[model samples]
Target: MDYGIMFQEENESMKERFDLSMERIGQIISEETVPQPFRDYFVRTASFIRMMGEYLRFIESGDQKKASIEVLKEWNRKLYEDILPGHKAALGGYEKSYADPAYAAARLGEGYGRLFSYLYKEIRGDIVFVHENRMKDITILNETFIEIYNMFEDEIPEVSTVKEVLYWFVSDYTDHTVSYRVREGLDPSLSFAVDIIKNYDLNDLKYLYYFGEYISDSELKTASFLNSLPEETVRLMANTYTEGYCRGFEVMGRDLKKKGMVQIRYELGFERMVKYAIENFEALGLKIILCRAAVWTVNTNAGRKAGYYSTSPNRQYEYDHRYDEAIYLNKAFKDRKAAVLKVAYEEYKELAAAYAGPAVMETFGKEGFKPVNKPEANRLDLKQEKLAVEMSNESSRILKQYVPGDETSFTIIAFPVPEIGEDFEKIFEETIAINTLDYEKYKGIQQSIIDALDEASHVEIRGKGENRTRLTVALHPIGNRDRETNFENCVADVNIPLGEVFTSPRLTGTQGTLSVSTVYIGEFQFKNLIMTFENGMIKDYGCDNFENPEEGKALVKQMILKNHDTLPMGEFAIGTNTTAYAMAQRFGILDKLPILIVEKMGPHFAVGDTCYSWAEDSPVYNPDGKEIIARDNEVSVLRKEDVSKAYFSCHTDITIPYAELDSIETIRPDGSRVSIIEDGKFVLKGTEELNLPLSGV
Candidate 1:
């Protein structure tokens, strides 16, 4: 079933529109009516568009796959060179790329800078459209360019006129863009990426160029490294990853057979492991939906990617464009987007219902990225910010209505990329061991911690040395100590290589400050990250990421609090994977580990939503038959009344390394204390075995 053929009539209609737009765009390159600096900008962009026209022809004629590796590399570079760091018109110190908001502000005046810059980025989506053979998408984008260029044909057009064109472009095209994104996530038949991964000669490495993403040494080396490994080793990697997904279903008591499809998200370099993973998933009667990450501004999120992708050529480029929606976002547009989203999901209700959620393969080890807060970038204003929050809440509700989060589960496993310095191979091997650790062993040790916690009212965590974390997390009262538990004895299931016992804390009494010397969450790094909490919700938070204190606080609020003024302390857990801690210490790559591995190395606290955000009603239990009952807190409890206020739609796990810990103790109702960890080593009687790995470090 080639889904592309279904749109043949639509594509035929779009061909005339595409050709007319291209002809008009070609005329803009020679036109003299537009003004000076802005005229050159349009001319350059028109040239790029014409270049993509040629590339599209090459791809449509089937020459791309038959071309040599060097030819493919040349095409890929030509498409992306204008924005790559050191290129003639790329972003950075002196390069004034049209894609850079700052550069746009400098070259054009501030009034029309960001608008044109975003337009350039929007046009860049042609690379994706051309590869996917989405002629309608390419045609509409060219039409948008021509529409804007027409304004310049006359005397200097009003900024309002230029903005009106962009605003309507986004508003009118919401149905097409948003619908395709939804369909891509749910429909396994939309198999652009699946065909390449399953049928291409992965050993040749030229298959890497087929995706049209920027290929870096990191991607090339990762593919080469995996290819060099034994077939058995590759199978072990795939088995560990796929088995983790199955184990998630087994542990949660969810029937995997009920689901028909699983979304496999990963970096571009792991096709070999992903190939085996595809077979393993298919054997379990699950179709694989391999969607590419969002290329359209409407579908992309800030500094986070959800589908298959490659190493970013420039993190700052993405960071600057994080809030590109501010140009046209209003209450009406927000409402329009919400309506389109609901309809899109309704159209694919069956596929959404059968969705098993994402099986994510993550990679870490890149140098920690510290984003610069550029003054010229577009930002959501106060009213727009409020609207953005409202849209987020509405969108979550709409999604849950179709694909209930409680009905599905996810598994995330991360490995190292080549960017983690000299110990890449050694660290990779250690990561495999960490991922496939003795699940039964950690389940027993974590159960002991849970037993102690279940008897307590709250837990006190104190950070030693430079880490200034002093927080008290109130636990849920267990009704029957014999059959109920506050903390869940987690193993390598949903969270791979897991070693934590966690519970949703009671927000009424939970309060204090959580501070870390340095941490990496998502694509940004925080320096001396600190948050003050009152009643388990963020009261005040600040970081040293920027020179100005306000800027630092804004960064924390944007990234951690997720635009919400305050977020509840959703989870409290003790990480017992000292072996993972030792490995990070030994390799001197503490900052390079992903949260999936880092969360297991120490006691971590999560904010926003609990581990069981939308699935609070789903029964979960520890290994010893005791039901883990603390799934929801005060915020989540509001779901019974107002679903809009129930969840924050985000969860960020911040871990405190064992080396930074002073002690963690549980306080009983009678004011008695039981020390679980003292001076960074487990002091509990039955959990002493976890400390063996700490001794080696």
Candidate 2:
């Protein structure tokens, strides 16, 4: 019976219902039915909703009469001003309003206040969508809030009763939210990004405001900087990025022609580069999908942003709300989400089938964030934690069904943001140089390192001066030593600025203590980080990030271990990019470099999934035409019987900087040892060329 027509009719009915619900809410806000403080809160919230509704209509009507540069700037500022640092501290605003959970619990009931805060935060995230004329989402959330408000009008329900209603709201709407998110990831037809990039005059800074992302000074300066660069420079940057992505497919032996679309994820300010990249990908017969990072908590995983985004207005606010799913997550909710995700993928099976993979442009050099642990933040219990992991596994399985992992390949490259320092331009130029280093030279140098590694039964690494790292990494045995190699001779392909030969090590004999004096991972800085491995899996881990030792351990668990009690050491490699290391040391920006580049600056170890991940069976070969055999380790081999237990879906690389290295040696079965590096300098006979960059340091 024409499901599309039926769905349209249902959508119309919902819109009508939403209007009536909001009208009733507005009336309720006028009447002082609830107590004084609660009434004040309702009035203020309802006023904001009314303003949003008006703004939604204004934009939907194509009212470009007021979309001039100055007007748009004011509009963007007004929209985001409340959450900006100074304004967020103002009295009775959104931030200060929900600042204290205990105070809220006292004013409202314990459960009611928590639920209300969650509702407000969720609604706040939808403001951008509302302005974009995507009202279906905001309508549903508003309708739900109205339903709960109606229940309070006549009588305030018990705390359990209120909590149950909130839970059911999330449970019932899971299908809608989950499906929309999955579709956004797959379907390029929803071209919010394409329209902006193609239709707007990019030279006019006003276009940046149309995205509804919080535009910071970094974004402004970045856009201006790109505008100031010659067209050739922009094209060069784009060419390198797109070429790296194409090479990834070639290297992995995947047919790029079979795929019709590619996902483009980057920070907002780099539109010039992204625009050129779009043209480049189109030249390769690929359409681009530019989705935004997840706005709703249900759609977010492990608090990492994906897709195109701007610099966050408040990292602490994001951290404070990362685990909001704890309010409603359960086995039932998990099952419901899994079922909905399956349906969503099935609906978009055709698009998913043609999906290539992500081409990501990561940015770094933001201010280091040290999050203050707030008691008000949600924390997942043991059962919920287990459910979260299972849910991730199940979702991945569903995605793999349509978009086969072996068929898709991805490339990641990073650039520095303006926040890096006064030397931002110098560093930016150096980064481009680093990214476009002579691949032929690196190919030859890395092959030498890999050749020496192929003869080793295991490799030992030890740290120098105040750094106490010591470890043994077991290499895969070569049955036909004349033709096979354990490590891949990696250069600038999937991983740009790449200068490393890496392998999935045999886990049985890999054991050690890995320590770093200081490092910045993701958005947080770690001090005196240490991890102990027994048979390759993390046996113990800790850092001195927080004053309390237990808090520090918790940070390690959440960030590196990724909530797993233990994860296997999946990868070990020797970084051959001493040039990058020297540049960072010269500029004093080592701590600000992203892992995409930093991982190649020294000997590094990865925990959790191997670099191969779901593509263990995919044949990969080096330049010399030898298949890399070390794709799967002890844990990944479990995929034959139980796929869920086979993958942890997280890989965190912890690197030992060259300054900390004492020595790295390859030990053969006959007890003969060949040294690759000693006292942080390349001492291997054939690889001495790498030391030229570090000469006289």
Candidate 3:
């Protein structure tokens, strides 16, 4: 029913209000009453906002669709020009706008400068929202900034007064932000992505400029490459993606018919694949919910991008602003956010009920990012850290209350980007082959390892060749040997290009050190990463990624431990995809592989929540008719008594390469041992087939 037009018409009054707010912003920019430094700040910020407003008007004008390729490229460049790699330094004013809290506090007085800095940062991040025609958000945010600017007329306001003004501003708008976010996650009518996918002529490269993401060479090249592929190849890629998602439901024994929608989380430039995927998903009666990644500090989680995104122009910018919420985070703010979230979920409870889960397509092969630890970065203090963890747990509980995790299923797949190097096409095709590997072959090999593991009380893994990893992972006791198994014979469902049999280890006796010479997690690269565990919980962790020991430790704490005192070893698995590992080694792109694929390259351990976090109670079985029973660890089992204590809501996998691994042995209760891998080669009775790939046979 032309919902986009309908929505625009319904919000005609909002557009008028937005116009008035932009005019007000312009007036503030020229006001002479404010002091020099303060006036400068306001002028620069408001000018940026005005530019965004103009962009918004252009988008709303419907001229973007008719614009020529050059015009669209220009618009796209203008939208992200401030944060582009080469131009970022020129935009330092935006960084300095909020950067030095101490300098800001000194310049604009203790309370006022900090608040203004945060407000400026918030406004800066909302440029994309403006471009996307999220008029209400931009309008309300602009009005708040103007309201604050208006307070500086005759005299500088009291510190307490400024704090109260900002606090109330956030509190008042909490419902608006939270409710719209929740609604967008479930409502298919908010069809920015669907319209772009179904309506736009995707073959035209100009269509890539429509989404408000930074258009980089990587994205442009990726889209061009996919465009060059045959329609059958594109269809096959989409079929693999959607079929894996469907298999997730079937394998888990969940009813896909019960769910009406699935969220598509992906990188930009893969819209061609996404377009095909949308059609395939529709055939399964699932509508697409293409939500943008978190742009606002309130919605962002520890610098991770959640939804559709482009290659980050500046990783440091993201790193510096990861904890921007620390400026206003307190018990009161936390409670207010939770309350608003509850109300929002309740408002959209019906839509949330039919929500299946996220189907994630991740991209890799970018240069390893080593973030410079900026001193000006906002960091959560001890109290805020505790509160952050609590809020995450509470938020998870609230979300599960509406979209019960047991009923939902998700799938994740990864492909290389053009940045993988000169052999991008070759690597891409090899990746496709790796993803479409003989699942039945892996099933047989992994089951042999799983059967060996199930008979053991604990497995011993020791690293060879300077890797320094030695660990003992306890297995859950099998209740019925004939009908129950500890590990699931993982294939390509849920986690694509897969070859692993994993289980939540019994944490009571799981102990030792896990070390990797080099590994990439999210965007950060770690060198000489070493994590020591005592009774399955991380005891001491260190990495030589930074010159300063303390700085390196802080990085580890933020990224891996996620500010927790300790995280339990939630999962343990042996990655049997020697073919993927061989492909990576052949291309010298092992360091660039995403965890989604790299986790299947060797034995890896995940810290935080287990694979089955909120869905621990859901019964799952392998193809062999044995129910997988090792779904919960000591920590996850606490869900029944207190869910807040049960899950950490973060799972980070750290893998050790096969070249560095010594041996993996199953230690039976009868004091006998069966070696699955010896000296980095599969030596088990039925798993010799896996060694062929590593041997280059």
Candidate 4:
């Protein structure tokens, strides 16, 4: 289907207004009406607005579909060249790149510099807007730029004037932006991304540019490598991914027949695998929903991408603007956003109800990015921080109202990107083997470990040499041991290449310090990370990422805690994937692995909501015909009374590698202990095979 035509009538309706915004923007490129440093900002920004208008016209003419590869490559670079690093000058050589918030703050006064740079970054969303034929969105942004520029026409207006313009722009447009985003995730008809994936020729790499995401060397080489793989190899990748997803519904007891749609979240350059996975899901009666990752400032989630995207052109640029919402966040705007979300879900209630949760394909092995926290960037104040938390709570509630968590299930798997090193191909193959491990064999082995754990009242974990981790986790009491198991016998379902059995621990007696010498969580690496838990909630935490201890604390708080003052110890699991640990050790890429695989390589603890966060009441059973009963802890139990206090809406797993381990033992109610793993090797009777992978280390 030609989905572009869906926007044709609307484009025509808004043509006159769009043309006027373009005409005014075109004049500002050369106009001397605005002042010195600020004049450069407006003039350069106006030039970018004109470029977007050209892109919109090109797409509207339908010429993009037939463009040659060379032309397509040139356009893709041109669209993002302003933000790409190492450029001599950005936006026409007038000054250093304003797209760099730090540079902009350096040139302009800190306040105005941050605000203008943020505005310019937001205006850049026009790239995606044009690709999707969002004429009204493009027109509104163009007008916003003109309005801000008009302020400077009168010899530097008060900062309040500029702030007011941005404040209302976010306020007034939240309805359109948030509503469209919610619908984009549910309604498959909004198929700007799906159309390109389904219709484009896989052998031609030119299709990468049509998505409008930044295409780096990593993405290009990744696509080339996949194209060279055998068809059977590709099918194996697709089968592992799709079957894990289907198995999520089956294992979790969610009815697959009730869901009509599945949202595919993946990186660019995995189209061959994603396309095959689409066919696999279609065979299972699922329509694919592929939405572009959020571009608008209001929709972007703290520099994290949710939908489909490519490698970031500038990680620092994204990091600096993560809190752009601080420019206009208030209780009124927060309440307005919540109300808009409810209305949007109301309109798409049917589609939302039919939605299965995300099937995520994560890529690892990029050079680690430790961002320089710039003082000039926007930071939320105390009141704003609390308001932000409230907004998250309300939004989560609204989402569950439409897409009930109990009815939806998700699966996640990871692969290595080409950026790892010279051993990229070897690492990729090894990753595949790790993902497709013998599921039946591991199932039986993991069940043995689960049986031992079911007899414990709590688990004792202590760190080996130089890794001072002393943690005691309280497990839920199994009511009727014959029919109950505390831990799920997890293996390659929902979480692929799975090798761990986990549970939500009772928080009353869960206490002690958890520490890791070096660990990567998301894009940031924490050095000498340590956290003190008192009664299952975070009492204190610190890291050595920054010279100043307080700065390191702030990083942990923002990224891991999601701005909550404290979070509960939601899950505890002993990883059984010795093969994966050995692979990382052989490649010496331990820090480059993603959490999806790393969490299965050692004993890891997760803080926030448990594995059964919103679905605690749902029954989950193991392969042994026993019900897994440890779904709720002290925090999650509050869902029956008050939901806002029940969930933190975040789950971050911090793993301690085998080399850093001492021992893990299960404590019985009679003051006896059963040893599970000691000195980084499995000592249990049935789990000795897990030690074979570490033999040659």
- Candidate 2: what lDDT? 0.83
- Report lDDT per candidate: 0.88, 0.83, 0.84, 0.89
**Tens digits of lDDT, candidate 2, 21-96:** 6687668657877765566656666766776766667675766335777776666665665555555534433355
Q: How would you encode candidate 3's per-residue C-alpha lDDT over 1-697 as one tens digit per residue?
A: 4545645653576878887888888888777988877787778778888888777767768887778989987776665665545445455533454444444555666556656667776787666675556667788788888877788776777867776776777777888777777887888887876787788887798877777777888888999999999999888889999999999999999999999999999998889999999999999999889888877668888757787888886676577668867777899999999999999999889899999999999999999887777554567899999899888888888999999888999999988899999999999999888889997888988888888898999999999978889999999999898999999899989999979989899998999999998888888889999999888999999999999988888889988888898999989999999999999999999889988888897899999999888888889999999999999988898888987889897999999889889999999999899999998899999988888888872
Q: Write down the TM-score of every candidate.
A: 0.98, 0.96, 0.96, 0.98
In the predicted model 1, the residue pairs found to clash are none
Comparison by TM-score, 1 against 3, better one: 1
lDDT of 4 by residue, 372-469 (tens): 88888898998888898889889989999999899999999999999999999999999999999998999999988998998899999999999999
Flag regions of model 1 displaced more than 4 Å.
3-6, 87-94
Model 1 lDDT, full chain set? 0.88
Q: Backbone clash tally for model 4?
A: 0
* Model 4 clashing residue pairs (backbone): none
Clashes of each: 0, 0, 0, 0
